[model samples]
Target: MTVSRTRRAWIAGLMLALAGGLTPARADEPVTVFAAASLKNALDEASAAWTQETAKTTRISYAGSNALAKQIEAGAPADLFVSADLAWMDYAEKNGTIRSETRVNLLRNAIVLVAPKGSTQKVALEPGVDLAKALAGGRLAMGNVEAVPAGKYGKAALEKLGAWDGVRTQVAQAENVRAALLLVARGEAPLGIVYATDAASEPGVEVVATFPEGSHPPIVYPAALTKESRNADAAAFLTYLRSPAARPFFERQGFGVIGTEKRS
Candidate 1:
């Protein structure tokens, strides 16, 4: 028999209560969100604005989309999930970890080549650009290309530009895009591939060039409520994220707000 939404929520709460031998949290408790690391600055500001406006508290955890999706799969008590790409959000939906009806494309970003501040590395991201030679024997910092959304997008852009093969052996993979950005910011790596917003947030790094949108899969950020979310305020927070008030914060950080529209 098909269960109703109310029944399913009750069952989920019961299961969690039974598992922990404790009562479910009150409806007004803080909303917890698992978000992509690249969204730190804007999201934090937006969330703070929400709190200031409504007096509702939020707890946001930032990490790689792959890591956040896996955490949701493992039953982390997160009310919302914001991913850097559609793939991991699709994975969460396929795994039954997110509410399919609540999912929406939220924001967009572009990948860029970044170098430490004061470095005179001028790069044109055209086909067959000698990215390896620009590295000067230094490594290119990127998130784990196998999983992290930023890394996957960076790799795709590099491959499309015919530069991946030349520098594939010189990549220094990090746990997340922010970590890779740090590698460049700290001068541990001579160059890095990160979102344009990331390069803007860190004064220590300067953007060399932005990858063509056609060079890689569109960098779309999708947000959704987790299947296990029971906080009464969680849905409101998700809605607030798409509201007009939140648009400025994201735009100020170089993100394109997609509103309720889905990317084609």
Candidate 2:
């Protein structure tokens, strides 16, 4: 007997819920997550574990946090958002796109200078260091300094170290941190500034020097439920992201989990 389309959809949803170990929601829709591109590896692993353990599935979209935030403001149907920095999260909060009560600062990261895996380049990321001289005529790659968080942080650090002015003309800005990392890994750029976790995730690159913490604002990843979310499983999955079960995946990818700080 041929099942009706509606009935077939229900059955499929039920099977998915059972496989994920989660109770069926009002609708069988998967929780949709918008996250930073830098989180691709670790978050994918964490979501996979959550699906395996709970039988609930998540649909994640990874892009630059600035782009994701803009999409959310434009009414994208995201159940959860994980930003690479606090500023975008704050932007979402101010725009009433995310649930203030569900917001939390979930992770911390560090910025570093990186070179292709076998390159022998090193420079102290301190005031008065001649970053342009160290570049040896190669451009420094980073995220878009005006919008992307990684680029903003890299620019801030350089400014603090008095290097921004000299190297501004030599910088190659990518759309996001991952793109910048790829540029370095592909040898398109001799050096790149990116999060330490990003460098760890790419085998073709190596950290040349870590930016001093005081050189820039702290790198924090903030996560929250979107006000537009309709899926009941979203909150549970968000909690799972911070659980011990998910910690290993994040830590393995070089992300440091921060204690949850609820907004409201």
Candidate 3:
């Protein structure tokens, strides 16, 4: 009887161990997202709302679109990517880092000139506008014009309006648009060229003028699933981004929703 009881106890312990090993881990791991810095405020709010409803979490990394695209190409593990422009998204897609079929244009924005809040600076953005004269010997803050999407758009608009030649030397290029906006807000730069949404997000800056739509390529924010994504909730998160529940946060931040004609 003693021998039999001992054997039964050993078998029961083995069964418990096997059962524990076979049990699956939790199913709600956070989805990792790499997104442009410009989307920080709106995306944060959207992610919060998503988590509340679905009980899933999201981890977002925000930076310049160029930097984020290069990191994705270098094998960063990302479930989703949101770019400030189509060009960087194109780069990721070309490198096979992004799943092209999953890509969608998610938002739109406009470039505008901004000044320190309460400043009386205003200028009409027209062809041959003397932007240098408007600078009054102060530096003009902008993103890295060679790479950052906001800077590229700002440069393109200036070039199209015949203002680049005059103000090119006075530019204080920042790593990203938000940084540029900060320069103006801090009075380090008297003027800044940034997305209209960016100007609106900061209380210390005010929109002075908006670039003409024809001045540069249409500003579109594109989002896609990365090839490295292992998250089961990634596709659902992408869908949620376009859902009515998420639209309000983006719109409140002055971003034009995809399929909608609103502009800030």
Model 2 pairs in collision: 20-54, 20-55, 20-56, 21-54, 21-55
Is candidate 1 or 2 superior in TM-score?
1
TM-score of each: 0.91, 0.89, 0.88
| Number of colliding residue pairs in each model | 0, 5, 0
Candidate 3 segments exceeding 4 Å error: 1-26, 259-264
How much lDDT does each candidate structure score? 0.95, 0.92, 0.91
Report RMSD (Å) for each prediction in the order shown: 6.3, 5.9, 6.3
Best by lDDT: 1
lDDT of 1 at 39: 99
lDDT of 1 at 102: 91
lDDT tens digits, residue span 1-264, model 1:
999999999999889877975556685699999999999999999999999999999999999999999999998999999999999999999999999999999999999999999999999999989998999999999999999999999999999999999999999999999999999999999999999999999999999999999999999999999988878688999999999999999999999999979555
**Model 1 ranges off by over 4 Å:** 1-24
Please give, for residues 1-264, the per-residue lDDT of candidate 2 as tens digits.
Answer: 989999999899889878977555565578999999999999999999888988888899999999999999999989999999989999999999999989998888999999999998878877899999989899999999999999999999999999999999999999999999999999999899999999999999999999999999999999999987768899999999888888899999999888566543
2 versus 3: better lDDT goes to? 2
As for candidate 1, its clashing pairs are none
- The positional error of residue 248 in candidate 2, measured at the CA in angstroms, is 0.8
Superposed by TM-score, candidate 1 places the C-alpha of residue 34 at a distance from the truth, in angstroms, of 0.1
Which ranking of candidates, highest TM-score first? 1, 2, 3
**On TM-score, who's better, 1 or 3?**
1
